[model samples]
Target: MATLLHIDSSVFPAAGSASRAVAETFRKAWEEQHPEGTVIYRDLATDPVPHLTADAHTAGFADPSAHTPEQAAVFAERLKLIEELEAADAVLIGAPMYNFTIPSTLKAWLDNVILVGRTAGDSPSVKGTPVTVVASRGGSYAPGTPREGYEYVQNYLSAVLGDMLGLEADFIVPELTMAPQVPAMAELVPLFESSRERAHQDATVKAKTLAERLAA
Candidate 1:
């Protein structure tokens, strides 16, 4: 059975989070396509993984036999996350914008899983894996927008997940997520709705298409 690694890092739950909501939509579509497939889910907000420590970082480069007890313990925890990514057929991430970048929790997860010669570098273990990221943001950051240059979530992930890790990365962005709640941006609510609708549609289509491709 195909395995999917789904990671959500939004501070809020699905009901209150644009990224989580869209991610859930994709997951539902994926589940429908593969009724018997396995899904390994991690909700970073609720159960955040440990931030990468010096021991964990140093251990990845050192031989396992040389690891001290402290290094061995932390490296073991990091290995579990790396193994999950390696075992997955596909990946889904809800990376909501926080301070114009990905959430710290999501960053921590990435740090744990990324090993220089293993999950990253010239020939990554999970190379060619497809990863769909829901990069929801509070405001518009498209080309010509004032904050366009400030959009770092997709750009950063592209470099890390694609260039460094060799994952095939695709993004579904739901922007202006704060429109409905912010009085000054109330007028953008309509645009937010449209963007959100488009994101959900993209999620469903991508999930089904990916499921079919994996099955093939």
Candidate 2:
């Protein structure tokens, strides 16, 4: 069976966030289809990992075998994160847009995964396999419209992951642009539920196809 990793990185727990709901829905359906498939989850909100430190950078510059204790520890941690990503047949990344971009916690996680020669080699245009990104915004940010001009999450995300890790990024954008004005229980709640439900179904099929590729 293929391995699937689900990661959520929303710092806000008080306000209901669309990205968290969507990620959970996708994870549930994926697990149901692939009952025996290994699943791993990392919630950056509950327990955050440290950002890339000076030690991490120094370690990244050192040779694997000729590293100091601190360097080895940081290197080992980075390796562990990448190994989890490499072993996976599919990946689900959750993020609630913060100031028109991805969360810092999620960015740190990406930093952990985008190791040279591990996720991607020295190539300039390597194609990363598909990764589902569940992104939520308080405003609409889909491309080709005026709203999209202010948005940098999807483009920046696709560029970094696709360019460095070769991941073809897919997106599930359940926008809550009109939420603040709507009635919570009657309007926003139901919208989030149905939107996430729809995204979950789509991601289920995607997960199956990804698994098939891994099994091949």
lDDT (C-alpha, whole model) for all candidates = 0.96, 0.74
Prediction 2 TM-score vs. true: 0.83
- TM-scores of the models, in the order given: 0.99, 0.83
lDDT of 1 by residue, 1-216 (tens): 999999999999889999999999999999999999999999999999999999999999999999999999999999999999999999999999999999999999999998999999989999999999999999999999999999999999999999989999999999999999999999899999999999999999999999999999
Consecutive 10-residue window with the lowest summed lDDT within model 1: 113-122
Native-structure RMSD, model 1: 0.5
Regions of model 1 farther than 4 Å from truth: none
